[model samples]
Target: MTLPDPADQADNPVGGVRTTSTVSAPTARAAWSITFLVMILQTVNFADKAVLGIVARPLSEDLGLSNADIGLLGSVFYVLFVITGLAGGFIADRVRIVWVLLGMALLWSLVQIPVLLVGTFTALIISRVLLGAAEGPAGALNNVAVFGWFPKSKRGLPSAVVTSGTSLSKILVAPALTVIVAAYGWKAAFWTLMIVGLVWAAVWLVVGKDGPYSVNSARERAKAGSAGKVERVGFLRIAALPTFWGGVLGMFALYGMVAVILTWLPSYFEQGLGLSRVNSGLLFALPSVTGMASMLLVSFLTDRLVGRGMTVRISRGMVSVVALFVCGGMLAALPLVDSAWLAVFLVVAGYGVGVASYPLMNVTVAHVSPERQVASTLGVFTALFSTSGILAPWLTGRLVDAATTPAEGYTTAFQIFGVVAIIGAVVMALTVNPERDRARIAAIDPLACADSSADDKY
Candidate 1:
């Protein structure tokens, strides 16, 4: 059998494959620019989602929403978001992502406007539903664009940069929107995010582009028509793989924790800890600051280690498993802490440590996937993992409603999900062997894996 190109060995220590030669300075600049914009765009994307949770308390009062109602409100966005994401990923695989991103950003921004004007529970629901639909494809597409710009070996930082937006948005949105909501009311917060979306869209229209890799990938797909087409690993086959399931399960647990935090953290502070809204916002942003640092550190370290010839399993997989366990423990200890500062420290530290896994997980999926299926596979991952958003918000709300005290509700919710995180960590640690999965995928898609080594027995 022909050996995989030595060039393919460079990008990732384990299974990564990049279709480009050594990057030129100008190309590197462009790639980094794209990475920066992706980070900003993700910041905007999450800001939109998080704004609702930030405003949830006041919005509930203005419209007479119960905890259950609030839960439903948060869940509405994912209803169509997931469905549209499925279609959107298929489209991204076949087309330029630049326009798709622009259109979605514009629509989500416009959707925010009606909520500010109409100011009703139904209006909020409609706005969130539309926003959700528009943003559904955002995660998959954004990552596709980012990955296109950089090689697999260099992906960790960019991936982390993009994923960091979720945490970064917490840093910015929580404090800024808190002040806005406090001063001008919750509607102002909506208006602020709308402007943010519109501005981000405008900037993206100027700077946004699908990188050369994406262009080349699309051309390859076009040329592979009919007879030249390679049979890809089936969706079910992909789903059945240990790597995929582990990633999905692990992400599900972590994301569930994230959802609960975004939707209820402020409420917890206000109702459970007896903190003021501003203080809650400040505290919320605090953990995210730590998260931002942790994100960058983890990504940088992964790349450095991989470059130094460490196994991907050690550099990426083990790191993530440890972070998950640490995060889970911190969360489980959250309800046990009585001091306000201790509670804040625990929550913040948990989220910060948890973020270390985001980029590693995304890179793992890419390293093990067929080149043409990257976007679609990521969409599938997103779809599966995003179920956490649906279950977490609704369940937390239900729990809170069932409890006599909001503190009890919040405590019970944290402890339960904490266990989930640990379970996911254990499964992921055992199952996500990148080397094994890479070989399995290569066996069925030789053409797709041409750039990848086929001789490694690991």
Candidate 2:
């Protein structure tokens, strides 16, 4: 099939240039199809991350591992995460993103092979490290790819949809994996994920193609003189913005909390709350149900607000600030609650409310960044915050090991993260001003800002 020249199509307008009269129905369908496919990729990506947590009890028992050892296993997966995330972001900016995604998915499948073959702790660490490296860039790359399919005004919902893959993993993939662990064992779950990754890669290889608003398409438009002059900016200059740092700090807290949830939540429910494994899995899935709904609602509303000419400060920044605060409050109160069900409610509500920040912060950062530098900027943003992944799991393990009781340790950990989330809210409230940041960026690179505003218009 011949690819449609972005120069000939007006549907995927960029930089305020309209090459055609109206967007075609086919183009819209293709955009959503690709968006959903990327969403599925995210589902698979997060499933890989959640598998260890789901099987934590069984894996720890079979291997005769302690809580600290399990935490270390969780921590090890992030050893190369930040570095690879940065490198992958840069790579995605220069290369075709479809190829980058395909490669990562294939590597994800291959990394599981070692663990499947060798069930030792050392082998597991090796697998985790490799998997971390492969998956580190997945989030940023996926968002950048999805952003290429939709205009600036319409990006929020799509971004939410893409990131919601994490919630989907918890809600859908986690329970299924838990069942597999219960019936067939932890190793069987790894085998299942490996096969799933390979299957996704095969399908992606055949169907994946860069979208009309992609970097390649931008270059093509430039060449055709349809898109105005495309100018690039230094990554450092972009990173120096207050908006960038604030979004990073807020996202850092959220990711740390997410790491704790992904690495230890199931264990927490089973050990700390005295729930059976099956019940714990079901409880674990509960938060994502709310999280998914909140995420979609927030994103959809943000897009609508932006369409109505609302400032991103209100549309994106304030929303994130509020979410962080709500999340922090609920998490902090988790330990104070007497009932196990109440504690569960805190986890579910806090996580559900706070997760709305992910897409908002992402889109906010993207708004301030030069279009060409978005992937790299997002990479740095993700890399810095994702370091929390390394620290959170390890520290929680240490906390649990040091506490007199597992329940006390778990409560303490949740309280600390809750405080972190509140602090994130304050930071976001002070620093996130996308309108101001966009103007600042415009002053540094006028053409970049022009392109950005033009893209936002449609």
Candidate 3:
């Protein structure tokens, strides 16, 4: 079947429903219910994939593997994640959000069954690849589905909430896995995911839809908004955007580090730091806790500061600089610590600060792209971010394999990675020539006129 024109960014979703604009209180409430349901699917996407890494502690011991081998397993996921993510944005441009998300959710989660039989490295590698492939679409497609509901002005918190699901998963997964792995063994964890997956599939069926309320719902609202809203943003144009590139590089640096930790850190704590499984998880989960805090606070701070007349660049920079500095200091200090616990503390602290940028594009896409194209714009953002995932884990693996000790591996690797984060910090700190892009965007506004289906309420 022919797909929707990839360049079309009308407010109408793949299902032909216009999913933007105000609606009746009851309908609006219904819309929120759907949006939050999507959040649950996304939470599963994060929690399932992340919880795997925590289980690596037990899984490795069961299989008698080294940190480097486990790192390879993580690398497999990134590789497949890149493959799926590479085209997820374009697919979002053409496909219905619900169908794509549902199919992918079921497809990826089914792969977890193989982990129960993971006695060999090759078998585990295949499972990770399947997991990555599943994850790729969920992150990118969920963004498209989400941005369709909220207006540009209100996107900050909602976007953060969706993105924060990953953190929420991290907080819950660490300790939970510690217990599950101890009692039922690694096999039990995958079985738990299997059950959750089926339940989530049911939730998506009931609550998932085009959006909170659509253009039709708008005229039904207490506050009737404007009329005749439309949008059209395409890959060709998004590729030329300077801010898009900035987000690409910035998101890459941030996620590459995260992929590194998710795959390698558990092994690092066990071998390099000499901690028990529970203590090691608690120590490792520190960054996620900090990340959760930043996810909420930074959005409010960015939106508030920018509203008070700060340039977009300056507003974004405020969080980036301080966060990166904290990240850098912690990373640099981690290897120097004599105590393993001290090292764990420093690493998590630095990582927490660095990762505040994880949700940066959620806001940037809302502002820089056409309202209707929020999902497609975010798809590219996630695509680029996943590309970084492809490389960072492998590179971390190579580094760990090369080093005699986990401390040396992380130290040298993070030193280089910290420099990369600093470069992003400098870029965010500098003011973008908004005038340059403003004119470029203005020149394209005429073409945007052709997108008569655009919904301006978003």
Candidate 4:
């Protein structure tokens, strides 16, 4: 048997329905509905990943886990995270994304149950592995689904809203889960996460469905009457793009910085700074709240600028470049402060400004790739960045273990990654010229620029 070309399938609907138009109220409503659901699920997803970090101390003491063991536990999740994400990207393009999301949510909830029941390092390891596999594709695919709802120029704010869930979960989930862990045990926190996952799955089943505009760039172009034929560009060509390379390095730096903060922040406060658990939790929420506000503001500004006919390089790329530099500066100062409160403030500011670039990174890749290829492009993007997830936990663990004090180890880690982030910012500023890249992408395949001339109703 032979498989169908995704490019062809994107252009030619099987049911002969006209679903790719911007002039419909019903479609707009559905798009918003799906975007809202994506936000909720994404929040829950981050919450699930975060629970382990929140409980890391207690779990380590309870299970008698060494620093290396904890590092292995964190690293184990990414063992499958990268491979599944690559496959998930392809599956997302070829299959119904609704079912993909549903299945992943279901599996994630089920896997968490085993850890709560067994409550051992082995069981916890197993749970993390399975959950990682389930979540690997989620980030990329959810963005793909969200992007399907809006036209190219209108994607920034919606994408920011989705990405903001990561920060929002820290705000909402952190304090609550911390209390749950304090009152009950780390096991109870796992149970709460499981329940949240199940609830999100139920809501998704009732309301989730793919958007009509889920077709690729070629089909979108045909709809706009800008092109007469569809084209399929290879991954090699996309890989050669400067925008791609810049996104690769910049996203890796950004994700690594965020991952370090998320996985180690609580530990840093409790173990390094001698804060109470509740105080640590409350402090952890600060950066996320700041991040939530910053992301929304930056994304909205980028969208408004784009709508006003600003080139994406100036509107989105430069904004991210500036934010990255700010993030690096803050991280570099985090360990330099004499006061604990000042240190917290610096770290929070770092996380806040660093994440301001998240949504723009998604938009940057979308701007330079075809619509059909966006998910795969983002999947590869997420997978590459996700290595930070592996490295942050394990490397921080090792550095701390090797140090004379936890504070010194953490200080070293922060300074090193801070420098790396500034370098990434430099690369982004130098390499990503979105105006030139967009035109180059259009030359490679005109469909990538579909409806660019369409009046901005959004």
Pick the TM-score winner.
2
Q: Pick by lDDT: which candidate is best?
A: 2
Give me candidate 3's TM-score against the actual structure: 0.83
lDDT, residue 61, model 2:
87
Worst 10 residues of 1 by lDDT: 1-10
Q: What TM-score against the true fold does each predicted structure earn? A: 0.91, 0.94, 0.83, 0.90
lDDT of each: 0.78, 0.85, 0.63, 0.77
lDDT of 3 by residue, 1-458 (tens): 12122223333332244434432333456656666777677767876767657777677777887666766777678776776776775665556677777777787778887776754677777887888887776776675666556544345556666776777666776667667878887778777777787788877777676653222222122122214333354556865677667666666666777777776676677766677777776665677788778876887777676556665555554466567656766775555678876776777777777777655555654456543454566666777767766676668768877998766886677667766766665664453333344346646764342222232222
Candidate 2 has a TM-score of 0.94
Q: How do the candidates rank by lDDT, highest first?
A: 2, 1, 4, 3
lDDT of 1 by residue, 1-458 (tens): 12233234323333444443342333567888888888888888888877777888888888889999988888887888888887887777667778888998899889887787888888888998898888998887788788776656677888888988888788877788889899999999888888888998999899888764553353454344435554456767777789888988998899888878878888888887889877877677776788889889998998888888787777888898899889999998877878977877888888889878888888787777766677877877887788788878889999999999998888888888888999989999998888778778777665554433222222
The predicted structure with the larger TM-score, 1 or 3, is 1
Candidate 4 wrong stretches, greater than 4 Å: 1-22, 27-29, 216-230, 447-458
The TM-score-based order of candidates, best leading, equals: 2, 1, 4, 3
lDDT by residue (tens digit), candidate 2, 1-458: 23233444322323345344333423677888899999999999998988889989998889999999999988988889888998998888778889999999999989998889999999999999999999999999899889888767788999999999989999999999998889999999899999999999999899998876676665545444535555677778888889999888998998999999998999899989899999898777887888889989999999999989889899988999999999999999987888998999999899999998899888888888766677888888998889889989989999998999888899899999999999989998999998787777777766554443234542
